[model samples]
Target: MDSISFQQYICNLDPTSLPRVVKICSGVYFQGSVYEILGSECCLSTGDLMKIVDVQLQKVTCENMENGHMFDLPQDFKGLFQPIPETPGGTQKKPFSLNPFSTQSKTAEFCGRLYSLQEVLRSAAVRQKRLSCLEIGRSEFQLYPVYKVKAIMHFRNGVVKIDSTLDVEVVDVTEESRDVYFIKPLMLSEVLLSDHRLPVEAEILEAPELPIAFQSDWVSCLSKGCRVHIHSKGSSRQILASSQQGKKGACHYFLLSSSYKGTFRRCPRKFSSTTELALSLGPARKLQVVVTKDHNSSEEMPLFTVGDRLRVLSLARADNPSGMDMLVCCRDNGEEEEEEEQVRLPLFLEAGFVEDLRDNKKYTLSEVVQELQLPCEVKVVPKDAADPLGSVSILRLEAQIKEHCLLVSLANEPSLAFEIPPKWMDVPLFFTEGSEKPSPPTSCSKVEELSEAFYYHLLKLLPSNVPPPPRPPKRRDSKLNNCPEKPGERKTSAAEISKPPFRESKSQESAKTGARQDSLRYPNQYTIQYGPQRPPKPTKPCFQVTGTSASDDSDHDYEELCEEVQKTVHKLQRASIKH
Candidate 1:
């Protein structure tokens, strides 16, 4: 076994070099033996193996060998750097990071571009304005000296605010590529929601972390490595049920399945069933029950009629009833104003009473959600019951309307076919092949929500890149902690200090930020960040009024501070007019 220290192993790897599996030699040598795999926390035991898929430079603690000063920078710092030249002595190569900033190994960035230390030293601008400005001109001069010369490293495991870089260990990012993820296997819910493409045949890669305790045919589908098809996007509408007999008795005899065969009548609207008559014409919205046949237990009973309409008035102050164990139906004659004339039905009567419904118009799927109660009879209507490509009775809707779902079934098997609910034990498979390539939905989610195991598995099948987040902002309190590394070489005037930092794309402006004016307000490309939504923060002012006055912020140069603004403006105006 080729064993190496954790740092050595990481330093020797890059995006293209991974995913290499490495075993822990000892728990004590690692940073806290506990590991949080893709947000699911678990312990990493000694001798246990983990794959290092990619490396990110979260922060680089750069130590200026010449000045012996140190500071930390995020992996996306945009300042230029030039490698410290050899002491007029030897030769050794170095490394560089290509993310956010594309600085080369050992050699630094200057004048918004990479330059050798000798090249920087040879510039006439560097010799005259070295102490005041970093805006090294190709030929023309600009203001501001290099404020930062540190490296930033980002690692995949740490997920959060881009401005914070990443909360990962300080690692040399050059050893790793700027791309890749450290993820885990798919969750059952993710697999279910993945039917982005309808009718995708899915093979479960892992068993769910939470077991489905309820026993059903679907329970068998939850096993690892089992293949299932993701058919449709489930409906979010609710299906309410009231079982007067019990849970078992209330469920209709028809099973909701693809292979089921059944016939269903349209809900009646005209002189329909007994219950329909009562509700439509009753004074209290009571359901009217019609006597199906004529019979009497007593001789004193009135002459039995084959078609008798008896009004069951007060199902009571009760408005809507569902899933009840018992029903009390009280009836009243239209002419009888007396309570004594009211007839109440026995709860345990052995007689069979059937449900009656009035005809409703042909309902669209959307109409059903807005208008009717489910478990009320419906046709299992397939959108395309006979497509040679196979019937697509269901549509996988990932659009805006996912709030509440209505159960859908085939019109052919209104009883046998059903719509899949948005959540709960739904059609086992969803999403499209559960593609590992991060879609808009998955990529927008916080990194903690991703499954590392599943991500890698998907990568092997269909490889793609996860969009990198915008660089994190510098820490606010960083100024309190870090001081200038080369104070003597980087003195600035009050005029320069008042010049606000430009809001332009730092990466894009790496070479031309010196030309940016304080008034420039370029809109950055909108990038999504993790965490809750917040109102847009206001733009930074040219200068804030702080308690500590800036009498002499940087070393004072009276001649430079008092330089004629008009002279520079005249030069610019003349140059523009000539051009």
Candidate 2:
């Protein structure tokens, strides 16, 4: 392993062949100064070893042929992805020009089967005419490998689908993989490579004393030869974390292991706009977008006013009348009942729109499968108003609502996603667009990294973590229960034993209270007021309790009514006595 310059080392390095460790040789200098980019040391530290996990192809600088201006296109910028052609024109083989034609394909597809060129020539009654279309006889046309290849071409007119035979160059869309050149995003990753991370398992050869806390036994365990898996997210040269080998949790911050030598995986970057997400996912359906702030009407911007709502319907269309890539959006009709108007604006719209907030209507995750479409814009809202989703705005659920669990990611940040069970974390959401049925989310990403704060929030809300409510103190036993002098002797009479010591209340006389208690003992003998009684409440539907809503709040009203009735009875008695 000869030490080479970082730029030279990764010059020809393929992104597919990543996770390579390159030890910083002596001090790599940038004009006698340390090279730092994005808070990451650019391999300038002396003796610092780093893992080049992955490199994401973000923007490709391409010189425009029309104006010679440098423009950048994102890696997933709907550039090109087509299938292989029947005949591949190798570089050595020249294509046909005006009045001049190249050799047709050697093989011909006939009756759903492939035939040799010689067999087709022999069967079709070969002719020597240089006609663009091959014809044997009248009403008989065999496959001449002519310009019958279907192609989709764009020009002043809208999209035109036809075979490339009308004196036109055979524009095969299948050559994007080989013909198109992709500029490498950075010195680390390759173009159009599947996601690959270097999850390395390394043993701590030498441990730094300051990284791990002294209070925990983990500090002692961070000794030489201690096996630990390094969770180095992203290709940052600085040490991120280390944990017990084979375990994903109970991690400790570890910097400069004794002899750590392993490559690192770069964390996926976050996407900021709905258009970017829609472009990544071809033919995205139900992508719901919410306007976070009001945008004033301007000539450059779409006709978006303060209160108007916008719904992105499709990806940026290059076939606009203005020739610019315009994002296709549906503008909600303001107060007036008008049909949704189509709006086309620049793809890189600088409007204040927050992703993930769907329609204003709120729905729990339980209703997702039955009620919502996939990839809808939404914000995770607490069932109670007091609890808030701090720093968390609207969330985009770009994936499917699972059978038991669902993942919701930040609308603005697509890379960071968290999974929560529908049971405990079934959050309600209002659509950001202020519509009835909300569109889906913009991001095509599934679950990614779960936020540590959100994880702790869920854990705290778990039934095991929450303590039960305190039970009311048990009623104290009465100390005034009378007992016979001699338990073994004759028992007291029933009347004496049954009698309870009575005290006159300040509001009532002793004789009257005793008589009232005696009358209460014989409920039938108690005097009944035969005064005018209010009629029983009507058994109307409004009075009837339906569904699960509680009617217990009305108990106070019932108590007040009872008090009013008692007051009337007492006033009547007083008036009769005075009279």
Against the reference, the lDDT scores of all candidates come to 0.34, 0.35
Candidate 1 local distance difference test against the native: 0.34
Give one digit per residue, the lDDT tens place, for model 1 in 1-579: 334434433333334544444444553435445444334443444544344444554444444334545555444445454333334455433322213333343322333455433333333233222221133322222211122111111212222212112112333232343342334334435544544444444444445444232223334445555654433454332222111233343221111222123222334233332223323332323354545554443331233244544544433221222111122343334345656344433122233233344454565544544454332445444334442112212221111122222222221222322232334333332223334432121111000111334323323443222334434333344232244345354444344444689586877786466335311321221222322335655743232222333455442232233344434545667877999
Cα displacement (Å) at residue 97, model 2: 95
Least well predicted 10-residue stretch by lDDT in candidate 2:
183-192
lDDT per residue as tens, model 2, 1-579: 344433323322344544444444543242224443334332133443334444432233433223444444343333221111233563322222211122344323323333333333222212111111122111222222222111111110111222212221111122232332211111011101224332223333344333222232333444555443221222211111222222343422222211222212111122354335344333434544556545444444555644456666654433433333455678766546777788765543444554444345555443532354433444445444433222223443333212232333333343333332334222222112221321233432221233344334433443441223223222323221232245455433333443589776766787788778644432221111122334544532222111233356754454454455556656767877999
lDDT of 2 at 338: 75
Runs in model 2 deviating more than 4 A are 1-220, 224-285, 293-302, 334-338, 359-579
* Residue 267 lDDT in candidate 2: 18
Candidate 1: how many backbone clashes? 59
What TM-score, computed on C-alpha atoms, does each candidate reach?
Answer: 0.30, 0.20
